[model samples]
Target: MVSKNQIKRITGLHQKKFRNEQQLFIAEGIKVIQELYNSSFEIQEFYSTDSSLQLNNKVKPDIISETDLKKISCLKTPNTCLAVFKIAPSKPIKYEGLTLVLDDIRDPGNLGTIIRLCDWFGIEQLICSEETADLYNPKVIQATMGSIARVNVVYTSLERFLKNTKQPIYGAFMDGDVVYETELPTTAVLVMGNEANGVTATVEALIQKKISIPRFGKLQKTESLNVATATAILLSEFRKNLSGK
Candidate 1:
């Protein structure tokens, strides 16, 4: 039983401009909402078709009909629940451990998957170029599953960040040193480029080292690996040697 005003507000969050204006973003499904609720992100509105669904037994959600839920859901088949959360304040970037950087990654799904990959490898800090997709984009949020709650993402100037950092910067390139053989530093910055363009020349110039995943197939015809897939493989290689230590 959502009011017309509430419906407009919630659906408006689907756009980046409206989301920024409202200082809020939407998350759907029990897992995503629950993970966010348990994290530092503050929940503004919670609506679900299931009254039995609970969030850590802390706050009860408003029960809404499925029709009303669909009115605001970004997904085609709406989940049983949706929650609007206040966009958490950006935290300071900690450069101690392996830091992941993105150079103009425009796809929301790619950005979200990369965030999840960062969470998987325990990479705490993710730096994105200002051109990267919005972290709070609903597609990105949905793709993150629940890992968005864990990773700290910041959007800034890639060139400035690279120039200012004392870390050994590495960029993923199709034509570069083999990643598998390269000795990765425990403390470094790894830059992944756009899906179509790879790393921008400006940022690529700042990379202290360039690494690539070698193609093993006989044809070697594949143009490139998907950015998120490349990220997972590279992160795995970076953390592989240090796993047990």
Candidate 2:
């Protein structure tokens, strides 16, 4: 049974301010918790309603009731387990290969999906403007599935980073060069912008190449693609080229 004090603290993690203060974040669902346990993130607290659900041969989770789990879970439908893990220190951004830059992507689900997309394409480092959604946001975490454990995400000033980078910078735009036609490099900085406004003028000014996914429908009336969908398409094209296809 989880005590009332413990419940309060766990529930507090749902907020960004509290998560920052505690230096810990929560991961619900067996897969997410298992992935984090297998990665560098250290497990701080583990709770589950089933005693048979083992993380591994070494660690044992504290068995709690289903009622207690709902109190701490962030989801509408609680998973079988929840684990609190220490926020791993952000590593220095390495501009070696295919660095993805997010320019104020405010949606947690979009950010989370993008992170998973990064992991899928083997893009190890992700740079986000300070205005981008928090990587540890519960919604983002849930959307990431287990990919959060594999990608390195960093938040910093977009303008400064763009100004200083030596690699070719590419920004996605509605009127830019079609991405399918452009010759993409294996190592470059690709900037994905906000969901509604697209890239900011300041960042757009710094881009060496502007790229876009063309519209194919007869009407061509679609306003835009979702940021995460655009990212998947772009990343696929980039990787497809990298393979010499």
TM-score for each of the candidates: 0.97, 0.97
RMSD of each: 1.0, 1.2
lDDT of 1 by residue, 1-245 (tens): 79999999999999999999989999999999988888899999999999999888878889999999999999999999999999987898776889999999999999999999999999999999999999999999999988898898998998888888899999999988999889998889999999999998889889989999999989988888999999999999999989879
What does candidate 2's lDDT look like per residue over 49-163, in tens digits? 8888888877778999999999999999999899999999999877688999999999999999999999999999999999999999999988998889899999998898877
* Runs with alpha carbons beyond 4 Å of true place in candidate 2: none
Candidate 1 minimal-lDDT segment of 10 residues: 88-97
Give the whole-model CA lDDT for all candidates, comma-separated: 0.92, 0.92
For model 1, which pairs clash?
none
